[model samples]
Target: MSLAVNPRFIPPAASTFVFDPDLVAEGRRESVPRYGDPIWSVLALTQNPSAPDDCIRWHWFSGTFRETFRFAAWTLVNHPLADQELARHGIAMRAKLSAGRIMRTVHQWSIFAAWLDERGITRLADLDTEGLADFAFYLAKTRGLSRNTASGHLTGLSRLHYYGRSFLPPSDRLVEPPWVAEGMDDYLPAASPLGGENSTEPITPATMGPLLVWALRFVEDYAEDILAAHDERRRLLNAADAADGPLLPDSGDALEAFLEGLEAEGLPVPVAARRGNPLAGAGIYLAAVTGTPRSKVRQVMRKPHWRTYTAQNHGPCHLGTPVNATLDAEPWHEPFTFDGIDKMVRHLATACFIVLSYLTGMRSGEILGLASGCCPDPEGPPAEAGRHLIYGRVFKIATDEYGNHDSAGVVREAPWVAVPQVVTSVRVLERLGGDGLLFAAEVHDKRQPERRSGRSLQLSTLNERIERFIEWVNTHAENRERESEMIPQDTHGRIGAGRFRRTLAWHIARRPGGLVALAVQYGHMRTLVSEGYGSRSRGGIHDLLDFETARSVAEHLSEVHEAIQDGEGISGPAARRLIHSAAQEHHRFGGIITSVRQARSLLADPNLNVFENKDTFLFCNYDRAKALCHPGRSGKYEAPSLDRCKLNCANIARTDTHARQLREAADSLVRQASSGLAPEPLADRMQERAQGLSELADQHDRKRVLAGMEGHL
Candidate 1:
């Protein structure tokens, strides 16, 4: 009583026949009349499976018929089925339909097989041409398949279907479906093996071998020792936790990795400490000091506590305690060097500046503030050979109340005062005659005075020139092709003015080697970073003595007498009295005692070294050397009168020797750099310079010859 139909049905687009209701009814009627049977009832079930059993219905008993019916009319028209005879069988039902399901699955398979069918397609091969054609339509239109997909399906199905078809009889008569056209291939992107931004370019050994050797031998070996020491430090700290600070950059391996990482990130591996200072002792101390970043220790500490100037065999002196206050460079501008410079105007200024800066290290404003009268002849010839020989007893230069220059263009002048060092630098200028502007200030407006006005160059202008010189020297030294790589950017990637002072301090305090060695080391270090200047570690040590602690000690002494009975065996004041009394007979004890008392009381508590105490006492009437005229004035340390010195002062001899050595070292560095390059790399540049020199020589010869010829004529 129930009607069962195949569960699967294809969309109408896959049908071979474009069925019209009217044509189907007429066909059915004709078929029933000829057969003289109730074919309509059975045929009705084929037309409608849902039809009432009492009336007519359509039902597709065959999966092939159902699948073929799903395709669009257009697809059916193009792929006409060879199994058209199956429709005349009143649609196969039940037992016959079960066979049709196999036929349908085969039909789907045949469409794929048709691609490889060649001309020998057949029915016993399991599907006829019509079934294959119908299945092709079913796949394309019913399944919404694009030609590529259809082609791919066909290729895959052909492997299995064609192999099966090979066993069939050739008389089966299967016709292939028409070929489906395809478009260009789809673009399939390749998967990247290593994702993100990474370099594909390999690091070749030719370029990397030398770098490797430097790291392994120089850096790694040194670093291993540093690590061993660090381990020792940790053990010590664990024993006495209060002594050491937190570990820095952790271990040697960590430090190494940090350096490599920075280099990889395009930064130079900063040296932990420079050479001359032998960072071992100080570096270990600094590495253990807490409360600040390592880079900043120099600024706070003032580096070397005592400067050991051996020229005169007095001990060391505290750095901040000025040896000669009048000789301070603050009043003058920074000096410029002209040794290798050849530019006309720049060289002229540089020459003047070198004389001034080497002698004074002045601020530019102070140097330019000098008047003609500032360089009056010394009462006698200089006792020394330097810029210090020039007299600077005129008005001391200073910015007006506004300080420096203001937007209003008013530059107020201050009173003149003697700058002891200025006297020496001015001698070089005085040789040119003090007639013109010493350092002509560049400005525009009606306020301008005559050309020789006592005007000085603006500080900014002088700084610009200094920067230019630095650039030129660095460029020549580096042979750099790009400017950006010459100086490093800060952490935030910025450049600034602090570079010069820092570089100078580093050279004086840290870096390794003698002058030549330092220069060579600098060259190599800079080359590694592509910067033009010498690479030096800017590490420092703080002065050991503290003014506050000294003051506390002095203050504590005053109250100690109150804590003990007057008859106490050894009172603090009694000890002081004993020392002072003993000093009366012993010269060394005298100076030391006096200095200690002064440091304990009225005088500013100084970080006194032996030379400093000696100098202090010599200045204050003790005159242990019997050299000073008055207590601590010019007369105390001044040169002898010109008539007395006769240009033969021993001080002048020492000064000249030092100056000559310094200049020679600088020149040697230049020469060493000239020889550093390989012959091949420099051949062309050398030839070009030679050729230019030869042409000039030839021109000069021609001129001389012409002059002789004219005279003969």
Candidate 2:
């Protein structure tokens, strides 16, 4: 028999059967449920301080992979192996793998298990080597998996078999390198062609120039309007609580009259509304805008206070709050989503997220993990000059022996050297999350997949909103009659994440005036990282990697541009003409690639193709470098390098992404100087940088102008 504990709201409505407890080990009661409960949710909420762990029916069910799915769903495979310690393995793996990874792996294995049971292979001891070989063949042919993908499955199986190898009989155990027989490679699916690297595109003027401009302005000017409205709403709700009695619930007449007497006699109110400014939730907004993992977003939301609230089928329902939520946004039967003050609060959060993410290259997860008091410590050691720091838990990198988070879902120990824009965002979120967590309440609840209740916002949602934020910028620009500020998408449609980071890095590495906004933000994370986030932290390392990748791309493009000036042969009619015209003018540009951004401007022309020479790792589309081409080459083979490029090489081209970054840098410097915040020396430097950038922009513009005048001129 089980005892049920119901959670009652402060207003004394019907109780919710939230935590169901089971008596185990001594008289001390634990909320451990039997076979049917979501054990993970119970385990998770069990950690909650305020939760009634001893005697309550936990509302959510979030057990391990096996508990939540195959086993819980009542698909009992009555086999000896199924009853063994593999369930423990699932939880152990969850420590290393993300929740998303855990789900996918569990699903895959569950399918394999069901297939095994159907084949009368209930126990591992009963299966032989022939069965293993047959299963591998079946997995490839039946699942239609590519060679690499099938290999991954086989790897997973190998690990599991290795785990149970000690307990199983020697004959029953699957051997290492499953097929020792030589020349049996033909039985498995062939591996797919190894695809080359996928470079993340940088945001460019030709790509999302206008969109970025509008987004920046929105962050600067319009975001406050929403925040102001939300604050005012909170103030009004507090005032209402002060004016009115706790509730008009149908209590006895004597109780009602006694309560009415307080209002009639002008006495103080009984209960107050929830406290804390909603602007503190800006971290949630940042996570949504920037692209944080769904897990971190929920952590931020849950802190400080639970965001999800539910109305228990009571109240007269005529509270004059915002029209966004006049009643319970969700019925008692439905899982909760934010309503009332939350609607206004979340609106501001959304705005903050969209604006902050575009301005700062902080990862979505990093932004979400941010706490209230985590940046630019004024009283830090003076030796830490030249670097701005952000203190927060980084979840992905520093795994323990069990591959689990260090504490309460936090994998902390380092400070990220942040930009001022990121610092400002942190400050804003500090106000929202206070000295506690950054995100809380109304987070997506994963325990009950059936309902959208207490959960963290999934990664998919954050990315989707990122796409939505882009569309919003375009729509808002059109609405404001600022068509020139319109941000456009690539042919693939939608702005990409990888290129955005690369673009920022390119500007920083190039040190161009147009991209100077991020200049003050750059620092060697290693300088401060040693004290906190040891070398193991992946967040700091990843940021550095982005910077390096952009630098490499810039150097390659510059080398190719220099080659063209050295009278390298050109491909295509337009490219040949461009070379001939450029030969007349003694112009040489590169080194600080952002100063010129030649690739961006030249890319506007229609008759150019940027193709990568996989052999040389250089972009060459002259199509004349037949020897460098992978196939269809008629000429003799000759080695090519950036130092010694022949005029016959056809594989020379560039991307406009870097050029646009340079343009932005110059614009930023101009803006900074105009604000009069920069020092005199810096101001002078800004003007000089701006002038050089304008000359480069003009050079590119001249080509465009002359192109427009083609034939007619």
Candidate 3:
């Protein structure tokens, strides 16, 4: 019923059945597949700029099309587009075809579109290979395009030219780009200027500033709501005028005022203190000054004595205020642990630094500059007496590798802050060692040039001795039960040096009753003194115990004994009450109580350590006024000798009374057994008294005889 008219001549590559104009038009409505999809490649090139005049098929293929399209759009919106310009024509064509999605990654395409808009060339048929080459030169020499990137644009253009002409007959003079001209192969290099792998662009610091600014702006405007609410920020801006000077200063009076204002207004500190550097520094400084996690500051305010919260995480003393419901309301991830550090490849100094860090929570740079004579033993043998002291400072040092060897390395004296455990641990490392770099220092080897610059431990001739130490610890822990407890189990592989310091902080914050007893003790004492106890004391208690000193003594006790004894008949709560009452009466007590019940309560309530007196009695242990006893009096407590013990043993239990009592008991038992006067009230019948009890009396006699056989047998 239909009559067929001769169709227009279709290329051989075209399907046998002529494509219906309606169908082709409808097909264009379908989404162009993503550039990454193979189907996008099948679409006919739609706009080649290098085609000769009157070449219809050549007009279809487009080179540098997508990138140019976006460029054209951007240029049109930002820069005026002129009629008859080649860039304008290209841009207009792109707007009709791709809409906009193709422009995302295609940066170079816009340059060409701008070129066309400026040149007044409306059609691809109007341009020739020479014209395209002129544009390429414009992009490179004039537009400041890198030579390699310009070459990439050239490659895409050439591909379009080749494919565009394929749609035309041989006689059609659709001139090709210079690079693709036949019999001129020698003129074209094997690869485009940007084709090689070496042409890849690298990000430099110079370029990063703009990106960083843009990203920061984007984050501020969109992702993070830090700058969203203006009322709170206005308050901070008003306060910022007051907070000038050093980045972080000891007295945060102005900062405290700002924070207090925010708290008074019932806003979160993080939310209220979010204005500028001083505010940021407030969060960080509070962490260092108070020794709590940056994440826990909110919880500190709710305590009954808010001012005393500084001692909560720093040690176990109660802060005056109740830690607010807000802080307790939030859940935080469990802090990092250091169970697998022995597997890390680190320098001995670095490892020692790691240990020092875990034991002391010192900053990395601070730990590095520790002096050799820091921990001197006051009472040991003259040659071995660096063991008497357990205190030091950490400083900053600079090292140079150049001709100025005279001033190559310099050390500075830092503020001296004493931590009993740190002092003891450092002394242990020193007494057992020799050192080059106290912490790992990056070194340059004068050996093979390529391998010349690397880091090494000077103490060991080759390799990091820390690795060996960690491996030994790991292996020993795996084989021994006692060591296993100290080592953290790592389902994930390897350990980092930073984790040690963090873990130390975590345990102090989380395990105040067990591992952090000493830290808790000292932190409490320091807080009390620093808070001006004399001024605040109700009874004019001038002989207040120095929190730091008391803490140090407690720390020494904890190091000597890992755990408080169980089955002590005293409940954790009861123990806390007893200790708190004692501390109140003595006015010189500072120690942590490590009872299981108290520890559980501490963990369950984050506010426990965030406020004063929350854990006052809970973490207290040692008696600064009397001799230190092992928890539970499990065994006879031994007096630590000045030459051997590193603890503050000034007030140890006197052994005279206990020794006399034990000697008398032994004599009484010996006499009763030896004289056959031991009473057996259970039975009236008497078997001949066994000599076993009599033999025990003889053994006791022999031991007594041996004990008195001193100096001259």
**What shift in Å separates residue 271 of candidate 2 from its native position after superposition?**
27
Off by over 4 Å in 2: 1-34, 37-101, 114-127, 130-152, 163-208, 242-348, 354-361, 380-387, 401-414, 441-456, 490-503, 506-513, 516-538, 541-713
Q: What stretches of model 3 exceed 4 Å from their correct place?
A: 1-351, 377-421, 428-436, 439-471, 477-486, 491-493, 517-713
lDDT of 1 by residue, 151-194 (tens): 54443333222222222223322333232122112211222232
TM-score winner, 1 or 2: 2
Candidate 3 local lDDT, 1-713, one digit each (tens) = 11122232122221222122232234332322222221222121211111011111211224433332322222222222232332422321221112112222133444555576678764455677778767766766676655445555665454334323433223322246675443223223243333221122222223222322222222222111221222233333344433333443334444455446655765444311224421223443343333444444434444455444332222211112221212124311121112111112122223345445544444443454444566554675778743232233322122234211111123322223334444544543343233422332322122322211122222232223434444554464355543422333333333443333333333333333332332324333232222322343221111212221223333433321222221111122123333233323223222342232333333233212111111211123323233232333333332111212212222222112222333454555555555656565411122222233233334333432111122222
TM-score, one value per model: 0.21, 0.49, 0.23
- Considering TM-score, where higher is better, how would the candidates rank from best to worst? 2, 3, 1
Q: What residue runs in model 1 are displaced by over 4 Å at the alpha carbon?
A: 1-342, 361-363, 376-434, 442-454, 477-603, 606-713
Of the pair 1 and 3, which is ahead by TM-score? 3
lDDT of 2 at 576: 38
How many clashes show up in model 3?
A: 63
Candidate with top lDDT is: 2
Whole-model lDDT, model 1: 0.29
The CA lDDT at 6 in model 2 is 16
Every candidate's lDDT: 0.29, 0.41, 0.33
